[model samples]
Target: MIRINRRILAQGALALALAATGFAAAADTLKDIQARKKLLVAIDLSVPPFGMTDAAMQPQGSDVDVARALAKDMGVEMEIVQVSGPNRIPFLMTNKADIVISSFSVTPERAKVVLFSAPYSVNQLVVGAPKGVAIAKMDDLVGKRIAVVRGNLQDLELTKSAPKGATLVRYEDDATANTALIAGQVDAIATPSTTVQTLASRNPAKNLEIKFVVKVQPLAIGMRKSEVELAKWINGWVEKNAANGELNKIYSKWMGLQLPDMKKLADEARAIAL
Candidate 1:
């Protein structure tokens, strides 16, 4: 009799677990967002077009625009969080943030850690060298002192494929990297192509141009895997915005480009879905 009761209890527990998971899988993230009346979002204040503080020190950029539009659609307010690349995902998992609107690249390794929305934009990493020393390929970087921002994807990629004999110098921000390049501290600077383009716009230096030798990274929003509902909500929001061209308008106004065609990328992600 005891063994039978124990087995029954175990079966009941398993049934409840499956039922909960079934409900969780289809939960509407929008409903939770609306109930909160405000959604917490993380973004870097430094990266332009994606996220940045304006002259008035207000959050205003592509990331901000997208978040605001989504919040508006959900009928909620937004809580802008300033974050760095290193800790962005941690913040989401720890409930420090509900969503990440930073210029986040979607990678297989990253997807394993968290849920990612469809690609909303494309960001290419570019090389910037002093005048008379333009780099035509990755091979040209050999022996060149490279400057990069620490705690960023650029830093990771540079370390992974550093040119033979090249010395990698890392800084905390783009300003420092640009300054290092101008001061002759490093022979070249590498960063997201669009980010470098934004910096180049401010200084207008022939030496600070973004090179397209490297491939582009498709940018996406991030959420905790446990927050799959949030991911779907963001996906729906992106679909709605893209279908209406609001995403394009925001991209043109901030990043100075059209939204990337993410259908292929999305399908590819589906093939590798966790």
Candidate 2:
């Protein structure tokens, strides 16, 4: 027979408590948000067009608008949780934010940790450089210094595709990476096409242009993987907004391009997953 010692009982009780805490942390985020009457959204303010502060230092960008729309539709107030590209997931997982709307590109690896709603936007990754640079292909990246926002999709994709001689310099955020490219700290930059456009418009003398298209990634809202109810609600919201053209208007306002067919893209994404 075995004795029921206090030490063993205490250890087992602690384990159960920890498991319960984990489950509570990940449970029914939609209900929690509704009860609190607020939605905490993670956004990277340094990424222009997607998330940025205007001259008045008030947050204003595509992602910000989207988050605000989501909160408005849900009958809740929005609280922006400013984050960097590398910490978006951490913030969501730690319950620092209810969801992430920060130009988050969906990937298989990321899906393992977070649940993504139907895509609401698309981002085209590209290699950009001054017009004087003769980079027409990935091979041209050889012996070049490339700047990328650390832990972003651009950084991950470029890490896999860049040639052996190419050197990648990681920065903490998109704004810093953009500055590095403009200041000649790096020969090229791996970033979204929107960044290239913003750079050209702001720094006309830099002559920055896209050298080659890297990848077209679908952007979606991200939440903790266990937030099934929240994911379902977000997916429905995206579909409804897409049909009503609200999403398109937001996209065009910041991206200067018509939004792609989100339904078609979502179907393609589902097919790829299967």
Candidate 3:
């Protein structure tokens, strides 16, 4: 009988091992989450209206409400995993969260690495400054110091359109950026419209006013790349909640702003799911 070559068998075994590794790295996350029986939601607790600690020191905000609604739809308990602006996506990539509901905006760059569900909310980035500040438009920001939370959608948008002479001071989070604005360390700030309303209203003495609109970003849930089943489930849940009026009520309660048109988004998501 002819003897089999040991080197050929070794190479074949190595190729099989590599294939198995690749498959494991891309395991079916949806089934894993279902097996776990609890959904791990990543949220940013420092952003008000979207996330923050209530008087009882429990997490509460529009994002928190959305997470609860999703958990309810899935018939699973929600475990809130607090994350900061810079760390939320990392947590998702490292398998620390089933999904992120932290006002995550969909961008083409981000789409390469993570899948985004249909938008559940709309955010308008606006420039906020003292009433007497002369910033009336993007051009007015030239040479002025503006604070923005680094890596946030507001930061990316503002940086894109900022005039050449503008000083875009990046902070670690919303609270710090807002503090820098209030303490007169920065001439103005670029942030979510809801945040501007919450902070300015709470500190009326500061006389902060919306200087101009920077950009409008649609916020959606983010999950691991190629999680088609999970994406479909989330989209269907969002569509159901929107039609039942539950989503609108939650947004109204925390944001105090009229909900954006979600019908088009819901329809798109449903089409994808089907």
Candidate 4:
């Protein structure tokens, strides 16, 4: 009996030690960023207005500005890890990025894998085609070929909502999809409204126009599920920036529109959390 009791206590102690180690490991990301003086941010440069390169090939976009702001707020230098729609979460999960500031839309499916900060921006998933294509509703998508970035929210939502006889051509990323739309490889493309506008402005010959909106989604920062402390910090940062009009300014500068009501979105996010 005495030997058994000793063995049980030893096992309990070992278990407690392991739990403590795990807790520390999980909570250390914020501290690690501070200690290293660099915040590694993941972004997709292919997605213009949200993320893209300027004429000088330097990164310039709303998402890039937001990431820079976050790094500045944290008093750390920013290091951008370029990623695509499908690879953003993978990079975060693998520690290739500390956080993802790409146009990551919040959804129940994605919430299961990564922790999201309260929304800092909004995304309207829209279908865009030549002005001549008469697509005013979902049913009009029937018999149309739609292009979308594979494994993105646009792809998932379009897949769920598009009618039968619609063909979806999946591209590796937003840049490819936009290219296909311009090249007339697809009849329409499902992407963010801002992206559609950017494509239209850049390629007037395509005569691209928004056909209809599929969904309005809130965009948030994405971090690994274990990085609760880091997520909390980012959420606080978003709230602070939102209140000060900084986020709105960034949105207006790149997107040419006012930001959505972040306070309302934050409340909604809290309700979701509860």
Candidate 5:
């Protein structure tokens, strides 16, 4: 008698379902959006400076502003669906969201599954340690215990480059990682620059300082791989907003820093063409 692996079967079923959703979405997502007259965006309402809920419980942040701007450019109403980091890609793959604007960083692995428009913003994953830890570079992580937020790009990056002797403990989120570092549960933490900055701002005496950069992530909007038309339209919108300095204004308003110069959407498009 043959036995089935329930886990494998379940995964297969989910893959089929997601593929069906993708097929239904097809290549003309822009047309569908126009017909429906509403753009569905998946955003994380928990991460601040990028996405969060205001006192009125409405999504308010840089990502939220960008989403609103995109919807306005499309001449459609905006509908936001809150999501966490782990589930954002799944939501897009399953056709539950038309696009993801929740600080979605562009990576080769993710690019294989979904299309990314030009980078909308950029952030760095940095290693932070207590004042006397004496860390200066990636090599210094050897023999140290580092904390990182599970399933985040920083975790992936640190996992890849961390020396074999280093111990990496992953917590559920940035808050947990920061807590562990503060309590001396870990020698250091790998997290976004924003997170570390906020931590330092809140507790000036903690003496947590950035040691080195783990990775520099270029964040972009995400859509189904099949949605070429929608990607093109969104890319165009991003280019226009960026050129008009609207995106810089939004970033400065939320992040308290001026947007840095980087490759624009058109440059990315040109690279793809080449």
Candidate 6:
């Protein structure tokens, strides 16, 4: 009791000091690793089958599982913050998050603004129609209303490939978008395959159907642009877990099925962990 290991004492002291003054808290995620016992992970709370609170009001889904596993491997816990799309990057910029574990799409425009972790998952945009809508293709939406969540990757994707005569009706969140579609405000909802699947399964609408008709997008973790060291560490961490097959288990749990022969994309992503 009288003799204490100096390094252990130092770590304990540092933890106490950081908790008291939050001085060490200003340091980057790596420093947060040495000082804080938990990793602060940001996620989108409105979307499902990715990152969001479940029916029990607890953070859950694919990205949430990955974050938890990564933090555990790093000898830390995870503090999940429910955030929105517009607020994610800004939150990281303000040091409110160690990393964004949200299903953020990696794009050239976005990559310039923040560092992206290796893609852990890929998802495709889909068209969802309730029982009576006969929207067989993008061209079928002439003068039709489509529900889309504002400030999301789907919205960006829709804007890029907007149909000739479709009206893009934006909503604040998925629940709103789905509701609007059900209420005849929108003929269909444009979203990712996973969200459309979750919506149809959880709250079934009459003859609801989800179909994939667009390019798939890669989902990655986000961090500040300058966090090269931590980003490197995260890339390694993700790759290692993926190689070990942990990501597959998590994917199956949340997504409810095996992705159709996309193991090559996952393997290539691991090889390019940078």
Work out the TM-score per prediction.
0.81, 0.90, 0.86, 0.89, 0.82, 0.82
**Model 1 — which ten-residue stretch has the worst lDDT?**
1-10
For candidate 5, write residues 233-265 as lDDT tens digits.
988887787778998899889778877665554
Off by over 4 Å in 6: 1-27, 259-274
In terms of lDDT, model 5 sits at 0.75
For candidate 4, report its TM-score: 0.89
Worst 10 residues of 5 by lDDT: 1-10
- Candidate achieving the largest lDDT: 2
| Cα TM-score of candidate 3 | 0.86
User: Can you write out model 1's per-residue Cα lDDT over 1-274, one digit (the tens) per residue?
Assistant: 0111111112222233233333334444556778879988898877776777878889888889888887788789998977766667656655667788888877655666667888776667777775577577777877677787754666656666655666667676666776787777877888777666776677665447655456567778887667666677789887777778887788888766676676776665555444
Best by TM-score: 2
How displaced is residue 249 in candidate 3, in Å? 1.4
Model 3: per-residue lDDT, tens digit, 158-219? 66677767877878788899999989999999988888888889899999899899877677
Residue 38 in candidate 1, Cα distance off native in Å: 0.7
Better-scoring candidate (lDDT), 2 or 3? 2
lDDT of 2 by residue, 63-107 (tens): 999999999999999999999887787777767889999998887
Q: Model 4 clash pairs?
A: none
Error of 3 at 30 (Å): 2.6
lDDT of 2: 0.83
- After aligning candidate 3 to the native by TM-score, how far in Å is the CA of 256 from where it should be? 1.9
